[model samples]
Target: MSNEVRDELLTVYAAMILHSDGAEITSERISKLTAATGAKVEAYWASLFAKLCKNQDLNEILSSCGGGGGGAAPAAAAAAGDAGAGDAGAAPAAAKVEEEEEEEGMDFDLFG
Candidate 1:
């Protein structure tokens, strides 16, 4: 991906993580998160992303981008079934798998 696009995606991912954790999405937070991913981004881009996401509802934006709750049910059901079979850790593992799938889906939606 181009640097611009990559930076934008990193910024968005950082914002999502922050939002999910109920943390404030600030430029400093974006920079830290992007750095945590080991991705180098321009300061201006990071600032721009922070500004853009500050007032936006990320959940709504993601849903508009085809990330609404339509792909998680089966994975959750399977996990629940596994849990019933006595594997207490199955739910977290299943959730990780589902998250990976969702990330892949988001990548396709964003890049295509």
Candidate 2:
């Protein structure tokens, strides 16, 4: 990915980590986190992200992507099912199980 996109995504991820941990999102905190993770980002980007998130509700932002209560799962499942169906010999059930396992293995809790 481009540096701009990577920086943007890392900033969001760091903010989410701080929000989940009930900590304030500050440019210093973001800078420390990004630097620790070895992501090269400009100081302005970290400051900008922290400033934008300061007065914003993370939950509200997430909910706006879809209904906050499990709405994304069905869409993902439907898409996967459709893809599996496109190939006649493909095992939809197995593919779904593998996908679920992969998701279960993901660790979104960056701090712990």
Candidate 3:
């Protein structure tokens, strides 16, 4: 991914982490977090992102991505899910578990 996109995503993840931990979000906080992770974050972008997240409902924003805060982020956190070699193991395992769950039967049938 491009540096711009990476920085943007880093800001988003930092905000999510702070929100999940019930910590206050700030530009300095996001910049520090991303820096500590050894990634270069632009100060301007961090400030802009913090302002963007300031009044927004973090949880609602996260949930809107259809699994951004919960399941998928962790997969991305491992950094394996996005890499090609890791795809073989991660994707199949997830699919197999999902298939098994379907086989066991769901508690409620949405289509019914």
Candidate achieving the largest TM-score: 2
Per TM-score, what order, best first? 2, 3, 1
Q: How far off is residue 69 in model 3, in Å?
A: 18
Give the lowest summed-lDDT range of ten residues in model 2: 86-95
State which candidate, 2 or 3, has the greater TM-score: 2
Q: Quantify all predictions' global Cα lDDT against the true fold.
A: 0.83, 0.85, 0.82
Off by over 4 Å in 3: 67-112
lDDT of 2 by residue, 38-58 (tens): 879878988998899988988
- Against the true structure, whose lDDT is highest? 2
Q: What TM-score goes with each of the models?
A: 0.53, 0.57, 0.55
What's the lDDT for residue 72 in model 1? 88
Summed backbone clashes in each candidate are: 0, 0, 0
Q: How well does candidate 1 score on lDDT at residue 106? A: 67
Pairs clashing within candidate 3: none
lDDT of 1 by residue, 1-112 (tens): 7998998888888888998999988999889999998889888877887788877887888778855666888886876886667876766787799899988876565455
